[model samples]
Target: MKKLLLSLVLLISFLGNSQILDPVKWKTKVVQKSDTEFELVMDATIDDEWHMYSQFTPDGGALPSVFEYKNTKGNYTLVGKTKESPYKKVFNDIFEVDEYYFAKTAQFKQVIKVTNPKLKEVKVYVEYQACKEQCIQQDKTFTFKLPEIKATEKGEEVIKEEPKEEIVPTEIASNDIDSTSIKTEKVTETKATTETNKTEVSNEPVEEEKKGLWSIFVLAFLGGFAALLTPCVFPMIPMTVSFFTKQSKTKAIGIRNAIIYGFSIIVIYLLLGILVSLIFGADALNALSTNVWFNIIFFVLLIVFAASFLGAFEIMLPNKWANKVDSQADRGGLLGIFFMALALAIVSFSCTGPIVGTLLVQAAAGGSQIGPIVGMFGFSLAIALPFALFAAFPGWMNSLPKSGGWLNTVKVSLGFLELALAFKFLSNADLVLQAHWLEREVFLAIWIVIFGAWAVYLFGKITLPHDSPLSHISVGRLFLALLVSIFTVYLIPGLWGAPLKLISGFPPPMTYSESPNGVGYKNQGIVGATATLPEHAHFSEHGIVAFHDYDKGLAYAKEVGKPVLLDFTGYACVNCRKMEQNVWSKPEILPLLKDEFVLISLYVDAKEELPKEEQYVSPETGKEIVTVGNKWSDFQITRYKNNAQPYYIILDDNGKDLTEQVGYTPDVEEYQAWLDKGLKAFKK
Candidate 1:
């Protein structure tokens, strides 16, 4: 009775697991479109709450749905690229990409021309993933027979159709499937490759670039709010509104003119954005963010802006241009109001210049053509709000605080922020050059000093060139000083190798630090114990003791009698850094990675030239593998059929998979379990 009860429990558990594994039913149909052409329709009837990804997923994103036609002979020719039904596009925080997925039902169609009409059937396979709480990859194949047509006595073809085959849903355990069998060769050539032959498909998800425009606009709006608090622009606000209110024929007229003036400000800034887009072109401007010299120049520019903000000097346009615009402003008309707004823009150049330059730089770096226009629209909206509001309610002017030493304080504080931001651009330049000058500790040290000086300035111990006499510090000033002091203190621990999660992206990364362990000497330092590793072993600046060469890592793993943990990562991969900081930082995962597995991280973006003897043409991509990155990129695409970053694969010394691969999973406990499973498999 006990044995029978245990058997029943085991059966129930296996059945439950199988139901969770499979969540979608797939069906295929051949729709007759023309005499020679036919549409191969692949439909997925997904289970409740489960979703499938689209085929047009971008690079550095989730795995896209792929179809492989096992075309051995030239019987049928592909018409064009496959088309998918409309899917919802959402920003996935885990993957950090705008991914497209479909729920309920999805239909993908591929048009193909039947060159050999006598051909009876063709075989095609598909690989896709479905997700709900967790994602599960699926591979399935189908064979479709050609429809038979008979000639009639009336000279019309009589078509005879066979009953469609019913598809039954099947659940397969993820670990039970072989990885090699699932990987398929990507189809390239099609008959409808020309522009005229392209099919009109409207159901595709919206482009990911368009989604980021809203974020850029929000950032620009916040920047405008910051600029409004500056000395040069803040005082001008009430003064400009007052001029319009007093000079207008009536209250309504005054409000109307003020709104027009606000709109003029928006138009002027937007034109500047358009001019920048025209000059640099969107692509080149975006490329500037990663360019070494451009980043260096931007770093210097920000420092100069910071100096000007600190009251060292002023940045202004020619006096003649301001005078001419001011003259035009004196005319009593709508045109005069525009000139008046333009005059204010020129007059406030000393303060607004740095803010505008920063906004434009960020927008340009975003790599979208409309980014600058959208950003400037948001910025101008924030700046224009107060002018229209004050003119509409003239009595509100009495509540406005009188600008004095407080304005100078604001300017000086901004100077410190600009100085801190300059270091980020400098760090970017250093990272691209692979120069270790501005490492984690050094970057934190600089920020600490800058903020510390800011705190002193707030407390009236230090002053800039344009400061008024400080008889005593106000309560607000004292509070600000205390906050700054605390922030400065907080940064000090970061120099000793704290994660400093708040400012994670600002620094050059902890891995690039001079000392990976901490500021002072440590027992298990990344560099100190490197001599223990075998010859030809390369260590990252973080001192993980890895090998850049694949063969060397596998050989070492075999020597150590351990499995290989292949980490496919990149230098510029943001999510890779995040995983290292958040997930890999866990005590359980860190030791397993450092001690047990042979860690082999292949950088898919490495630019180092390969040896002449090693360089060759990639059979898969048909591109020359001239660099280290190219070789590994081809290897990943050909072997595993994946090219995404932060990809982890646990393999035995013989290069067979010990466990299924995963990408950018942040759940530490789950990842630890995965590692344990791999280790267990290796032991077996």
Candidate 2:
């Protein structure tokens, strides 16, 4: 079972990066409180596993949602403050404060008295912070068209129902939200989370997508073959094949039952795959990678499985359930064979369940429904094939290796690997949270210790709780021990940043270490790399001198007679991290960025508050620019005409562009070339 999980992780490490998440939607409606009084109703629809902070956060750790009213000045007089729906509160570990937020939906209301009856509509946008694995502050626009209202001097007249103020619902994109662009209808009726707002999943099969799914299928098939080598399932092949031959009256009937039995196992696993999709919602498998709870839960679950496999205790299905399943195999005919397959599934769950779960995780990471289905289909096919083939020819059972002490050796080895695989999840959570608990050096050290101990155990120096007495180690065991020892030695260099490309994804990125250069590395005042730092300039995580404020960085660039690397990034932006790890760390690019450019990294999601005197309302959005992030974010929108993170633009000493801006360039050579071009132009 532990081996199953180990192989599953090995295969899944090849899966691609995570998807971009836009988790909140917004809409609004206008309500006539009386003839001249109107109320604006705005609601936000949040996606699963994500929550948005309330307008008035009680403890004030997270950025609270704020609203901006546009084009409603002289025509209407302000009523009371905006009232929010009831929200839930929870303590945040990062900020050490309780935060108020809403899951699924959050509603807010604002009432206004129309001094001039000509007020026809209302426009507002909400800026809020939403968090799941990482926090993101984004905006959504809501345009509410007002209905025609008539007021008479005689008395407060009851509004006529014939021409009610109903609004045709519409979704406004963040960048495209303005007064003149959005098309809206004036009716009182309003709707939210409607069909227009639903994010559609394309079931259309692309060639590359199918190829990726097929790769998962093939890898899962190989994993299935590996699972058959485990003690739990390997010994059962002979027992089950013999039972089929004895029960059937004729040889052909036995073969038929065996084939049917094999398919039943496949069906069982396919159901597991389908369950993964259904449980996570229709097709949320794609978005599961960045989920914080999922990583934490998986880490703990795999550790428990590893402990069980290490002979600490047996993790087993309920005895009563197993007994009932075994009893069903006693029934005669086709039903009995199907039950026999079920019996095997129940009995060997300790072995197969972990592998199946690991495979599903791998498939789910692929972000395709077909990957899970086909991957499981391939996995169960591997498990079932040997049973059917051996039943058809009982003589083949003699060729199978007899289960022995070697099986225990394999199990213990896998338990060690299970420990290794478990940390990958924990590391993922740590990276997501920037908790710094398991940096690259710490992680590599842990793996070296784990693999080293396993090698020592394989040499017969240490016997586990279940190991049989052995006078001497087998040649096979000695050879594997040597291999493990060499692999352990190979990992030692990774502590000092050897890239360790062989085990890349298993550990955190090279930059996410104790020393950005390497373990125990220090700058001996390298001329271009290290110098007297200017104001607001500090060594960034990438080991390059960086400034958070744009003006300071630009001034320094002018003084140094170098260009500027304007990085509009966010702390939680996954793409930005990817670029830093894969592109900036390149031998060709890192030095150029360090020496040739004064790098300014303006974090669009930074949580620190700006100076009180510097804060004001944004002229464009009318939202308050309170935080450092808010200032940088508005600056990016106004200056660069872009709000997306991981945005890079090379500028001359005057802070003018030297090259075209790019976002998320994955190709290292292309990015390096871009930097080279920018440098050449600056020099010219």
Candidate 3:
């Protein structure tokens, strides 16, 4: 029966892949810049299983899709970069992504700055890659010279390119003594634009990030739940309540002690939260976010957490130290009982340490003013719950399960999970700086091997020194082991060039693979072609070079007339996805892309260099513009003065503001209005 079920599942999987193959479709649009200059916008849609590369790949990686104007007499200026709409899919252990496109269409745009406005003919050449299991590289050339149109007397078609020249040069001098003069002018102009644009537009006001009493209550609720499972708290619930019942010689007195015990746990945990807040100060969390060493240290700490779970060693405070507190319970007062609880926490740290570590890490990462307090609330609630419940109903203790080897198993499993979670942070570090080694596939390979070994260990095929002997396994255990083994097998296809669609962009893009090109198709067919080719897409021949630096991209943008599209995104920003899907899809919006804009996506979470010359200290806040993203972020914060995303703006040829900046427009109508405002501003 099991074999039959497996076969049925495999068949369904094959059918899903057979459909949704990448579809190659293309479209174009024309935007008039002047009587002599017109922009050509062509969009290409490749089938589901393929992707085109950017212009800059490191050594041994896929070539950046190349473009050359062909069959043209007009002077054409290359734009900064091509823009792609974002895609989404679940990320998994395979470390690869399936590049999806708009069903049957993709778009590309080119701006032509003609030396002679009267010229009627021009040509374009493009080279790119498209693939399934095998990639077919292709090159195509097309001539798209404009057809003549007679002028209308009423100025209906008397299109005069306003030649609204912008001072956007390929470079800006940071210390151009006139920079101060420019700054004053820039600020005044920005304020005038904002005032003119404000007409009290009607839209639903977004709820601000929640604050006040309810937020605190919610944090407390979550903390209490986490504490319930701690070894120190669960077992002691019945013991403490039973002792109170017997010694006090009355149910009421016992109930009173139990209530007091729960309150003591809360107080102690809250104090810890308070102390952390005092020591770190409110701004420490924000500072840590950008501090590279903190991230590295976190990575190492999680590794230690994983090892401890694997039974490398018990992590606990000294017994004498804990015993000193435990001994205070004999003093017959509320403070003594509270000390006893603290002693229990210290002594049982070996068992409870992972949970505490995880909570603290989460708190630190959240970096909210009340983060520690919220975290402590969750911990104390979990610890306090059982005491209240057991005291209220003494008979329920009979139903509680006794501690056994399964408890140890739970600890080890969590350790494995922590180890896995650690890599995500590492991956974040790698991708932020565009480190190529931690490609999606490589990350997956490590995870698959680790989890596979864990499965084997779970089944007793591999045993830790401290593990309990397994005389025999239950059917349930065998079934779980089988499930994990099958999942591991699923990752193997990725090494041989599978997208592993389950975990798409969450992993590093497959463009980072050792040999991402068609394994057999290398060196034998038309580049970016429809023709079949040899398929051994070897690693040495094809690798993906990661580029995370914005300054570098900006330099490339200037080197190449591509307008820059700034995408201020976060690793955890859900709204970023909403903007990508909801707004970037309209037909009018997609086509106007090339004539007026160069797309530059700046992920706020990315880590990379800021050119030393470009870096500076912000006068307003005195913060260093440390990374490439930081420079852009500083610009966004100081100029627009808003950090919340998804923000959009358009700049002219001189990299000066050509439009009003818009932030977080979720409504389609509002988005269109916002975009239109920018377009008009650019035109003016």
Candidate 4:
């Protein structure tokens, strides 16, 4: 009898741990509005607390609902894009975009024109994601028979409808009708279907194209300042101004000509910006920021630039091009001034080319149509300012310091900075690909070594190919050396696991580290206070006692009589790391996360393949689930209708919500309050 009772208890536990929750229901129907025109409606009856995303979610947001007509060649033509019922629009913090979703119920409709009289039925394959406490991917194929129409005496088609009392399997409320019934209602465009009648318009202004102009200009201006410190451009300042002072007929003419030269420089760079924009288009350039191949290319390009800056070799324009442009400058007029500007550009190419390339790449990544133009404008303004100002005040030339080895120091320092920055692009690629080779500790170590070498070089302990022999380190050099040495020391603690909040975005996240559990630097504020747990307690990658599987988490929560804190997260989520480091590390919040609630961190992007027996076809999306990520991603969508990471929900052991769902809230006090509220609700 005792053995039987123990076996029964074990069986119940296994069943509870194996339960998988799916929370969405769908129905489809075809409604005849006119004889030739019929509306195909897809209705979703979502479970309570769950929601469905609309088909119009913006780019960089959650996947939108989609409907694909399977067999439309013979009998029907798709009239317009899918139209959806009213949905709630809210700003999603995780993706930093406005997203639309529907709770409880959602209806999508597509108008179809019957092309052949012999048409019998219409078939549609629908795909959507639903979310509440979790998400699930769902797909369904719906078939609806076309209603028969009879020809009258005059050959006009009339509806042969059933009686109103007859029960229809797929009937919708009359008041819940499609807005397409109104003549003025516009159909919402859907990416899933194409409309043949829609006219393509060009030269239209777009919102994304207008963004980041000012930011690009500022960054370009800073790039120009850095260029001004380079060897090729610095010596030219006094020489060019002196020529205007000595060669011109009068001071006024020299000033005027110098201003014209400045304008010419702006025009030249602006034309270059325009050419680049024309070549690639703003959308494609913006997308390059996230493209792995583009990032790898950028990494290699930057490394080459760093090598050049370190005096490995000079990256120069063809001498023939400069000579040709210089020859044009001998004409001696406005055209000559423009050609002179071109000559300056060609001559300074070795020094400024890399800076210009970096600036343009960064600006283009911002996804603004005017980014290149604004960046060029700012860069030109900086290069042009010295020429215009010094030409106006010829006497100021005496105040300038003579150029020497210090300029080389500037170049070498920039090389170090470039080398450091180059790794960031590499790290971005590594993180996106889930290649843990450049983990946080490894990245920090590399940075420390690079900066330490740079500090030694600053103090004249080391020298590059172009560096002059140092008699002694100057006071300024000493100060810079000290600063770099201190910075290198600061980064050392990060290897053992320090938050290093100052350079948080540069390195791979702390969670993606060799010691993610804070093994060595336990005293660091980021390390969570260890808690005693039952022998069966499972922990996350970060060493926090948490469950990676949902059913196991809920079962544990039930056993412990504690509420579950469902953390919908991703491995690559940046804000999620910020929250963990800044807010969750706080005294007020850490205890609750560690002790008060049962933390269940579901990594939506986990790529580990599930066991073959554990994998199954997703009912919602009709895709084979082969990995742990797919299962959790599907769960989040099906339960909560949200696809963004860092989503949090507090639920009782019964899997009911104890508090409202929150996402990526970084404020410590607010998060603590939220946790306290959930705890109170749990107790009640």
Q: How do the residues 140-219 of candidate 2 rate in per-residue lDDT, one tens digit apiece?
A: 66665665767433222122222223423344445325322123323322333222222221222234455667888998
lDDT (Cα, 0-100) at 542 in candidate 3: 24
lDDT of 4: 0.71
Give lDDT tens digits, candidate 4, residues 1-684. Answer: 954764464345334323344455555555565666777766666778776776655333445687888678877889867776555545444343445567666777788988887776677766666655334444556666565644323312222344455434443322112111111111232221213111111222323233346657887898888788889999988878877777689878998998998899889999988887887674465455556677788788888888999999999999999999999988988998899889999999998998888777766655445677789999989988887788778788889778889888988888888788888778767765767888888889899999999999998989899888789988988999999999999999887767777776578755567777554643443344454554445655334578877888899999889999998886545466667767886778777787788888888767699999999976755566778987887777667655566778899998998766777676676677678878989999
lDDT per residue for candidate 3 within 651-678, as digits (tens), equals 6445666545555456675556545555
Q: List the lowest-lDDT window of 10 residues for candidate 1.
A: 175-184
Our tally of clashes for model 2 stands at 6
Stretches of candidate 2 off by over 4 Å are 1-140, 144-219, 272-277, 283-288, 360-375, 524-531, 540-543, 554-598, 605-607, 620-623, 636-684
Q: All candidates' lDDT scores?
A: 0.72, 0.72, 0.53, 0.71
Q: Could you arrange the candidates by lDDT from highest to lowest?
A: 1, 2, 4, 3
TM-score-best of 1 and 4:
4
In model 2, the Cα lDDT at residue 559 comes to: 90
Q: Per-candidate TM vs. native?
A: 0.63, 0.66, 0.48, 0.66
